[model samples]
Target: MPAESAPVGRRERNKQQKLERIVTAAAELFSERGVDEVTTQQIADAADIGTGTLFLYAKTKGELLLLVQNSHYADALERGRAASADARTPLDGVMALATPIIECNRVQVENGRTYLREMVFGDPTEPHHAAALAIVGETEQALAETLSRLASIPAAEASALARVVSSIMFLTMASSDAEVDIAQIVEGVRTQVSAILPR
Candidate 1:
């Protein structure tokens, strides 16, 4: 008979519980006050853990933000993917894929912009940062898949176009104009996307 897998130990469970608390606390605080206004000590206090313990999970506030926002970004991406399935054209599919992400980024505009900055500049050695980067890769992959719906677009070209689309989306989101609403950002992306797509 095959050996049974061992159950999780108390230590592991405790660690997981702590991580969950930290993520929840950070998410709430970040959403309420924005990442710039919330401090690490406040997060630790909200999570009911010490600052030292919190540091173990995320060395900096940015990593904590990543831990919280990564899940949100992943969910938005999934929604976009589902929405893209019903699109009738490549432009429609690409916009359907990007719209949710734009909304997600605008949830708290500064926080969204900070998350993008961290994704670009944060230490890749950190697990949370790596996960954020992986999500970006997945977004590009999804875009490429959507673009490939055009029979004329080969896989390589589709991938390249997807990168361009991804860049457009990110740039729009990370723009300095905080007054730009989700619709405007989406429209900006759409126009750029329309320009690049084959006629």
Candidate 2:
């Protein structure tokens, strides 16, 4: 008598794998070719799917770009969370979070450089714009949470500090000549936090 193997219906898994592959292919091409120059047909070819098939997952080229950025950012956020989990000080914890920010930038430098320059070609009037804004808002919230845990700042103050540091992250990412030394940024943040509190 032989043991029976467990059932394995792979359609969903296969579909997800294909979607990931497609996104990876798109990110590579987009990084190399700039988002504006990389057409859906090119993404389809890169993904080994037809243009129509690519369109099935993404409504437009802009939507595909959104997917890439959103996925990449999510990965970075997970790393940030893991890095900051054991931080003792709010500054230390927030600093841990910022390391992932640098790691994320280093990993996605090319695609990000291009994407920021092109602004994803996302229409200002589209509902997708709100979705993108929400992503930024979530990032700010994460920063605020870290700050809240690190110091005695009120929620409002913590949120403001988070926004400030985030603005620094954006600026640092954009400046090739101005590489963000996370240590320096963290120190600066600590100084700012300390300034608002007393003995």
Give me the displacement of residue 165 in model 2, in angstroms. Answer: 1.3
Structural similarity to truth (TM-score) of each candidate = 0.97, 0.67
Candidate 1, 1-199: lDDT as tens digits: 9999999999999999999999999999999999999999999999999999999999999999999999999999999999999998999999999999999998999899999999999999999999999999999999999888843588999999999999999988898478988888898999999999988
Q: What is the Å distance of residue 45 in model 1 from its true position?
A: 0.5
Deviating ranges (above 4 Å) for candidate 2 = 1-21, 31-37, 59-62, 117-121, 124-132, 177-199
By TM-score, the best candidate is 1
Residues 23-49 of candidate 2: C-alpha lDDT, one tens digit per residue: 998888877876778889889888898
TM-score of 1: 0.97
TM-score of 2: 0.67
Stretches of candidate 1 exceeding 4 Å from the true structure: 1-3
